[model samples]
Target: MAGLQRELTLRFLAEPADVNFGGKVHGGAVMKWIDLAGYACAAAWSGKYCITAYAGGIRFVQPIHVGNIVEVSAKVIYTGRSSMHLGVDVKAGDPKESTRSLTTHCVLVMVAVDSNGKPTEIPEWVPTSEIDIEMRDSAIRLMDMRKKIGAEMEAHIHP
Candidate 1:
């Protein structure tokens, strides 16, 4: 069997259609791109259809202007019985500039599914490098944090 792919990177040029009334790339548009990149990375790793089960800690640190070069990178940091935890980072800068600042960062959980849309088991991923091991550990830590946050949210009554 071929080794599982753990990372994917996608680049796009920000256009007028992606901008908001503030004249910067819209948050919704960036989110859509994030999901697409995460899905692509998960599907390729699992060799099956995948869906976004959860996306958390999405933070737009800086604005991306129209005409900037945007790069979305997704890396599979951890895996479970049927899910993969991905760390996605979005960065953008002017084409003529040499530096790109981080625009957004998020963690996405993607689950593999079968034809009927039921979750299916995927090949187990083992960390082969020091960086991969550290990433996996970080994913585990984040998972714990997510559970705690979710519990807190569930306890709060909504209007």
Candidate 2:
């Protein structure tokens, strides 16, 4: 809507407990942050509770070390009747540094839900900037790819 927020940012420090055997932040930890950020953005945009329907194109571009400041940013790029597509980016850097590099990126689809947990209608998201338009188009393209993949998987399973 006119005054609604479409984006969210979460910042936290990577802790020792979040590290994996490789001495870097675990992939699962980053994924959880992505989901949390996406959900917050989706719920804010829809003004309702939301649940994650899909998450895809997860890319780990760099490693996050313990004590690094991690920032997860999420924005709504597109919307269906009950679903919102979120583009999420995770960045990490040393606490004493001034720059953070992108560590992970993903797109997630979250569906607004009612009190009974059924899908509920959500306000449409309109792209107002060039970047917003491009991101929305990208989300649409990914959705199309997912449909084709799902169809192929279904065919193989049935055959």
The candidate scoring highest on lDDT is 2
- Per-prediction TM-score: 0.91, 0.96
User: In candidate 2, what are the lDDT values of residues 54-121, reduced to their tens digit?
Assistant: 99999999999999999999999999999999999999999899899999999999999999999999
Q: After superposition, how far is residue 9 of candidate 1 from its true place, in Å?
A: 0.8
lDDT values, one for every candidate:
0.92, 0.94
Q: TM-score of predicted model 2?
A: 0.96
Model 2 CA lDDT for position 33: 95
How many angstroms is residue 56 displaced in model 1 relative to the true structure, after the best TM-score fit?
A: 0.6
Candidate 1, superposed: residue stretches over 4 Å from native? 1-3, 157-159
Locate the minimum summed-lDDT window of 10 residues in model 1: 1-10
